[model samples]
Target: MNPVAVSIEDRVLALITEDELVSLTEALVAAGGENPGGTEEATVAVLEAFCLGAGLETLAEEAAPGRPNLTAVLRGGDRPGLLFLGHSDVVPAGEGWDRPPFEPYVRDGRLFGRGATDMKGGLAAVAVALKALKAAGVDLPGDITLACTVDEEDLGIGIRAYTRAHLGERFSGCVVAEPTDLGTVVGCRGDSYIDVTVHGRSAHSGRPADGLNAIDAAARIIALVREDHERLQQDQDALLGAGSWNVGLIEGGTGTSMVAGECRLSLDRRLMPDDNAARILESLRERIAEAGLERDGFAVSAAVTMEMPGFRTPEDHPLVADAVAALSDCGVASGIGGWTAACDGGFIARDFGVPTIVMGPGGLNDQAHQVNESVSIAELVAAARAYALLCLRHSSPA
Candidate 1:
């Protein structure tokens, strides 16, 4: 409904070419960049090449080889700056695909490939936006920093290292180009991975009564944790909703013949702003104790294997308002929502306290990480323009 948004949207649409968009998508998939922590050389190479092609100066950290995180700065006039964050790494291509997962294919106007909807499409859109900005000769009011990081799928080690070591106190605000179905993602749930180990006694199968079953103890603990999570659901927030937990993995028993002496369970807990990693762990420990399994026959211990805190920007925050205005200017409706999934935005928001938003092309149920995962070309073009307008608006003075 905003007239300014319509103009910006038209400009963005005018700049994105179908051939160019297709080529970028094809190139990214062809690069065959897989693995987290950015160790995949092919992914790093593709990102570097794309940045250079877009006429941006790219820098990579030397501490980790093959796994490189890149940043490029586009300078405008004196105004508050904006940082665009993304990752080049895609999750491993699991089995079963209509076509080869790495080989890009277009059908029904949608580009199908691994990482198509999850992120590579978003990356390509940013590239196209940068190219459009240069071609349009639009005088930027401030600077724009585009950072393509590594290892968002596994842990955010790549971006974390880069931010801590290099980009300390550099930008005013940031936007993580995560897939949000072209809607404004104002917040998301925080996540922590905990490893739980239960100990029991191993005995010969002939005398099963002499030994305890670690698997049984773990199952009881899991049930108690699930029940506690359901209780936590009553405390949901309007944006982030209630925190939750899941027992992602459980392993026990050395072999079928012997009673299992030890079992391990990996818990994936999503936290709300009211919760922290330590608090979540304590709650789990309490639940285990309540299950009456705290004796010598059963043991429980937890360690935070990974942690990514959640954050949100006030609806009226300058960064949030500016981004909404820009998206509106680009002919898109401006609304806010929360993402259940985690991204590097957590690191950016938690570590730097920057007002960060997640906005990108593609739908929420595009079958990401599934066979025939794909993104529509129309969405890609629209996303490119949105990114360009956001860069222009944020890089401009108030």
Candidate 2:
């Protein structure tokens, strides 16, 4: 620790500079393009180089081959440190961009490219913030670590591996640099992906009565889910409200001439911060059984495929207060709110025993994963300044 008790200015710092911020964001967006379950190696390589080039102490651990999680640690002073979290992968750029998706460009004060808003841009912000804070000779109250993971857009294996490894560690606070458009999100809904499979005997459509009719059984499950959804509406939380359900996909039937033997329903269940995924699944199973799907030689099974836990911190908690204050200090208008969408930060808060908040720059609803995805240059810089200020204000001055 340098032991320099200094206040960060509202304006962009001269150390790392704004040009570097923009440049880094562009490089990250370009190298970070990944389809769901695809390689994040290219993006990880670029980030590792940036960390090493900045002379920050860094480590790269592979969550899987070609999927790496990075931790760039800036050793500070004392216990109960702060953790900065982010993901390196982005949804694939499918179609509709004024320019090439990987060819990052800035116009009208916005940086446009895939991953500009959803994340890659936020990753650059943390990298720039840590680099500038170190160069400015500010002493930290505790160790500040930036852990960027992979597969956030898909299975979330990166964060899962990370949390399991650090189970014994502790942190005072965590900041997930997801694109929240400068809002300090204190609570967020968790999410789970479920696969509901219904099995029955296949028979010729000409004599459909010979088969148990899997498609018909599956419909009953969907109906049960619909009723539960309405019940959720009756009970709501101020921050996270009630969890919602969506049956996104349905596949069944081998051919029109035959009765469907197997049908699968892909469901999305959003959870309140306090909801348990396992229990939720059990309830759904019970509903299916009580709905009587298994009555006439029909079997219905629901299994959880993927899970992202939700989290909530009190509004008056010091972490939330410090985050709001930091955003205000950076000349950004920000307030505490709840996110309808889920993020990797939930894992840190729930699993690491760290009170976490989600805050960053970029449009969550509008720009993230959209065509010509982009983030305001000013917002990007403000986020960098905010993270640095949060670290300073959160830790006791030396």
lDDT of 2 by residue, 1-398 (tens): 23343334432255656798899999999895476856788888898898878767988888988778888988777776789999999998988789999899999999999999989888999999888877766666778889999899988999999998777866788999999999999999999999999999999999999997898888888998999999999998888788999999999989989999999999999988888889999999988878777877998888899999999988999988888888886788797899989999889988887788999889999999799999999999889988887877785323
Error of 1 at 53 (Å): 3.0
Model 1's alpha-carbon lDDT is 0.78
lDDT of 1 by residue, 1-398 (tens): 48975575566568878778778977887776677534556766776787777677778774366577777766666666778888877888888888889899899999989888878888888888887776666677767778887777776667777777665545678888877877888887888899999998898878988898888888898888788889988886888887888999999999898988899999999877546898778877887887788774677777888888887777777777777776775677867888777777877887776788888876656566677788888778777777787776564335
lDDT at position 17, candidate 1: 84
Q: Candidate 1: minimum summed lDDT over ten consecutive residues — where?
A: 389-398
Please list all clashing residue pairs in model 2, or write none if there are none. none
Clashes of 2: 0
Model 2 stretches with alpha carbons more than 4 Å out: 1-12, 396-398
